[model samples]
Target: MTRIRREVLTLPAAELGPDNPLPALRPLDEVHRIDGRERTDLPADMARQLGHEPLRSLLPARVRDGYGRTRAPRALDALVIENDRLRATVLPGLGGRIVSLVHLPTGRELLYRNPVFQPADFALNGAWYSGGIEWNIGATGHTTLSCEPLHAARVPAPDGGEMLRLWEWERLRDLPFQVDLWLPEGSGFLYAGVRIRNPHERPAPVYWWSNIAVPEDRRVLVPAEEAWHFGYERRLSRVPVPSYDGIDRTYPLNSRYAADYFYEVPDGRRRWIAALDADGHGLVQTSTDVLRGRKLFVWGSGPGGRRWQQWLTAPGTGGYCEIQAGLARTQLEHVPLPAQSEVSWLEAYGPLDTPSTGEWTDVVGAAEQRLAAALPRARVDEAYAAWKPYADTEPGTALAAGSGWGALEVLRTGLELPGTPFPESTLGAAQEPWRQLLRTGVLPEPRPGRPPGPTPVSPPWRDLLETAPATAHTEYHLGVAQWHAGDRAQAVRSWERALRRAPEPWPPLRCLAVADQEAGHHERAAERYADAFRDLCRDGHDDDGTRTAAVAALGRETLEALLRVRRTAQARSVWERLPAAVRLRGRFRLLLAELLLAEGRRAEARAVFDAGFEVADLREGAEDVGRLWNRLTDEPLPARYDFRMRPDTG
Candidate 1:
C-alpha cells in the first residue's frame, strides 16, 4: 500500500520577500522574441498557435522581485508519498514541486534535488527556484506560481490506494488545474495524472510543461531524428538530433552554451525522454499521447553556464539539466482549450535499468524495450482512463492551502469545479477587499500608511470598479484594469483622477511613470519616478522588512529612469537615501558603478567591479555586465560575471 505523510526538509534558503506593490502592467521585457525571419520555417499550425492569444500583461499578479542572496538554514514542510520501491517528497507550498525522488532498490536519487531554496528571477511574476519536477503553466515563460503555494489533499486513487492531489486555480488563464500523484504497490514508476479545465464560457489559451531536472553528466535520448533548436540568439532552426554542428548534442557537455532542443517526435511514436548515466542507470519520463512534446534544456560547458549552475545552488554541488514534456510541439505555442472542456493525461517517472554505453540508437532501443517490460505505453493509457473518474473524486484530508484567489473566483462566479474545491474557508486578507466589493459593491480602502493590496484587473473586476463610486482607491484599481485592457488613454485619465484625491502619490505616480515611459516621454517618466520614490520613502517607517523592501525595489526603478534621462545628480541623491544594506546588494552595487561611470568616475566604477559581487537574479540573456566592463576598460570579462547565453559575434 502507498502511504502519505507530512515531514520537514531543512535547507539553507533565501527568503522570498514581499511582492512588489505595483501592478505588472506590461509583459516582462525580453530581447529574445520570435521575429518574422525566425518564423519562416515553422509549420503553419505551430506558427498560428504561436501568435494566438499571446501574453500582454501579468496583471492581478504583482512582481515578486524582493528576494536577496542571503541564506540561512530553514526547515520546509514536505509531504512524502511512497511505497516499497520509491519515495517521492513534495513541497506543497512551492508549486507542489516534487523535491526529491529516490528509488528504494538501488538507493539512487533520480531527480536533481537542489540543496538550497534560492529564489531567482525566472518566473512570469518572478521568484522561481530551480530543481526537481515543476509544473509550468499559463504561458511561454515559467509559471507565476513557481514560488507560490498549491492546495494539497489526499484523494482515492483508481487502484484503491490513496493519491496525493495538488490543485489550484491558475490566475493568468482563470483555469482550475490538478495533479494527482500515486505509486502502485511494489511498482518502481511513480504516476502523475494532470488535468487543466477551462471553466469559462469562452475558449481559453492554455500552456503546460512538466519540467524534470536530472543530473547533467549523462546521455539524453528522445525518439526523433530532428529537433527545433532555440538558443539565446532568439532564432529557431531545425537541426538533426544526436549530432548537430559536428558535435553529438545528446551529451549535454558537448555544447558550449545554454540552449533548448524541442524534439520533433513523429505522430505515431511514443512520447518519452530519458537521461542515463555511464552505467545505463538513471530516470525516464513518459506520458500519454495528449502530452505531445519532449524537450532538453542544457546549460552547457561554458563559464556563463557553469556560473549559472553554481549561482542557482551552492558551489561544489553537481550541475543538472532539464527534460521536459509539454502539450504543444514546442513551448512557444499555446493550445486553445474550448469552453467547458478539460485536457487530462497520465505521466510516469521512474528508474531506468538499461545499458547506457552503446550506439545512440541501440541505447534508446534497449531503454524502450526495458520501458515496455516495466511499464508499457498501453498501461499509461489504461491508467489515464482509470484516473478520469477519480479526477472528480472529492478531495479528503486537506494537507496544505494555497492562495485565496481561487476561492474568491468561486464565490464571484459560482464555478462548479468538483475535485478542485475553492471553499470559503480558504479566503483570507488578500481576498478581503475583493470580497467586500462583491458583497457591497464598494472596494474597501487599505489601512493608513500601508501599501494597497493586489489589484484584480479581469473584466469582471473592471466592470465592478467602473460602476463603483470614483474614489482614489477605486480609480487607482480601475486605472490598473484599464491599463491591463490596453486602454492607455483611459488608464491615464483614471490615474490622474486618483492622484487628485490620493492620500499618498506613490501608487498613482508609479503607474503614470510606466505610462509615460511606454509613450517615449523619457524625461517625464524620470520626473514621475523620482517623485514616486521620494513619496514612498517619506511614507515608509523603515521598521518592517516589507516596507524596507518596497522602498529598495522602487528605488531601483527610480534610479534607472533618472540615469536613462541623464539626471546624474538626482540619481546620486536617490542612491544616498537608500538604506546601507540595500545599497550593498549586488544589483544596487552594479547600479552604483553605472552611476559612477556616468559621472565620469571610471576609476571608482572599476574599483566596484574589482571588489567582486554577484547579481543573484541576473537575467538569462543579459549582457549588461560585459557591456559595462568593456566600457570601463578593454580587459577580459571576469569569469564570475560572464553570463552571456550565446557566443559573442561582435
Candidate 2:
C-alpha cells in the first residue's frame, strides 16, 4: 500500500472534563501481592547513596496537597496526529511526550494512556511518568527537558506525508537534539527520525535512549534466552531473564516479582523485539541495527517492589513494563561526536494482531514479517559482531558452525550466529545457574549438572573459578552457592572477597545488605544500601539504573526491616532525608502522615493525606486517611474534590 496523507489536529487547549475516567487498568491483584501486609517502618540509613532522586532539590514537594498532574488538561498547544490505521496525541507543553497512541480501527489504546500529566520522581532529570513512549535525549538517563515544554510543529515528510517535529535543549552540555515523527497514511507504524547534534565547537558527548511503556499482562519476546547478558553498576554478564527463584519468566509479568535486566538480543534474522498482548495484539519496536542495547523492567505484580516505585514515580493508573532501546551499550558509555558533528537514526513502532499469541514461532514470526517490511533483516555475522567487543570471538577464527532461533539454539538458529568463549572457563554447562543469579540478583537452585555427592555445586563453576579466580563475579557466585547450600558464614566471606575485587560491587554488596537486614542488622543494612549506591556511582554504571535498585531496596526492603524493629525515630529520619519524590510516595506518605498523627502533628498529617486524593492509584489511601483524621479531630472529614471522566458516547 502506498503512503496516504496524514492529519494533524491542533487543540489550543485540551480539556479533561468530568465525564472522563482513566481506561480500565490492569487489576493490582494481577501483579501486586495481596497476601502480605505493607511494611510500616524503615531505618534512617537505608540504601543511602543508592537511590533515585531529582537532579536538583527544586522538585515540587511530592506531598503537595490537592496536587494535580503537571500534564493535566489545560490551555496549551495540543496536537493530535492521525491516520486511517493509527492515532496519537502529543503534549507539546509537557515535553512533547506522545501521551497516547490508539489503534483507530479497533478503538483500542495501544499505549498506556495516563489520564493525568503527573510527573513523579523517577528520571534523573526529575519528574517522570509511567505511560506513553518517551524520547530520552541529551545526557544519559532521563533528560532534563522531559518535564518541560518543547518546540513542536507540524511539518511535511519527504514521502509526501505529514510529520510532527519536537525539539528541545536548554544548552544542556551544548547538546541539542531534534526528532521528526511520522505515521504513514494507512499504516500501523509510527516512525521517528532523530538527530542529536553537538552544537559546540569542541568534541562533545552524544546519547539517546528511546523508552516505550507497554501493558504488562502479555508476553515479551526477545531474541536470546540463556545467552541474554545482564549488567548492573556498569559490570555486565550474560544471563537468563524474567526468571529467578525457579520462576519461569515467560509467565505473565504481574505474576512475577520485581526484576530488571539490561540484556542483549542475539538473534541475527529478525533484528527486532515485540510484546504480544493476551489477545494476540502486539507492539513491535525496532531501531537502526547500531543501537545495541535493549532493556526490560517489570515492577513484579508482587508486593515489595511495587511499594517502593509507587513511593517514587507513583506508577499511577496501574503498573506497566518498560521496553527501552538505547543508542549505546550503557548510558555512561556515550560516544564522542566530532566537533560540529551530528548522528541520526530511525526507530519504528508497529502493531500485530494474529490468531495465535501463545506460540513463539507464530507470534515472533508474525512480528518479524511485519517488522521486516520497514527494516532490514538481521544478519548473523553482523549480529555476532555486536558481541565481539565483550565476547572472546576472534576475527580470524570462525564461530562454531550451526545456528537456530533462541539462546540454547543460538548455535543452531538459521539466521546465523557466533560464540564468545570466556578464557578457558566451563561456562557452557553452568549457563542457566549463572543466568539466574544475574537476572534475579539471587542465586538459583544448584544444578545437578555435576556429580551429586558431598559437593552439590555445579562443576562448570569450578572450572570458571579455576581460570578466573581473581574475578569478582566468580567469587560472588561462589559465595551465593555456598550461602544457598546453608553455608552462610562462608558465603559472607566469599561476598566480602567479591566486593574487594569487583569493579562494580553493587550485587555483592546487595547480598550483604540483605543478609544484614534479615539478621536484624537494620542499621548496618541501611548503611550498606547507601554504600552500595555510592559504589554504583563510582563504578561508572548508568546512575539511573543504580537509583532504581537503591530506591527499591531502601524504600521497600530496608525500610521494612527497620520498621518491624520499631526504629520509629530512625525511620522518620530516613523519611526526612529521602528525596521529595520518595517521601511523598503514596504508601510512605500515608505512613508519614500516620506517624505525624501519632506524634500529635495533625495539621501536617492532614496535608499528607490530602495529596492522595489527587492521585487515582492512591485514592483509597485518601479515604482511610480522612477517616483517621476525623477520628483524631472529632469532626467530619473534608470533602474531596477530584476530576471525573465524562461518560463516553460509544
> Number of the top candidate by lDDT?
1
Give stretches of model 2 more than 4 Å off.
Answer: 1-76, 226-237, 241-245, 250-257, 267-270, 304-318, 331-333, 355-366, 373-650
TM-score of each: 0.98, 0.49
List model 1 lDDT by residue over 1-650, tens digit each. 78999999999999887788767888775533688766767899888888888878898788888888899998999999999999999999999999999999889999999999999877887789999999998988889999999999999998899999999999888889999999988888999999999988899999999999999998898888899998888888899978977899998889988999999999999989999998888999999999999999999998888978988998789999999999998888999999999999999999988887667788778888999999999999998899999999999999999999999999999988999999998999989999999999998888877777788788889999999988898999999999988899999999999999999988899999999999999999999999998998886474557678678878998999999989999999999999998899898989999999999999999999999987866766678788889999987888888777787623
> Could you tell me which residue pairs clash in candidate 1?
none
- Per-model C-alpha lDDT, please? 0.90, 0.50
Q: How accurate is candidate 1 locally (lDDT)?
A: 0.90
Which digits, one per residue and each the tens of the lDDT, describe model 2 over residues 533-616?
A: 445434223232334324433454445545555666655655665556645545566567666766677888777755653332
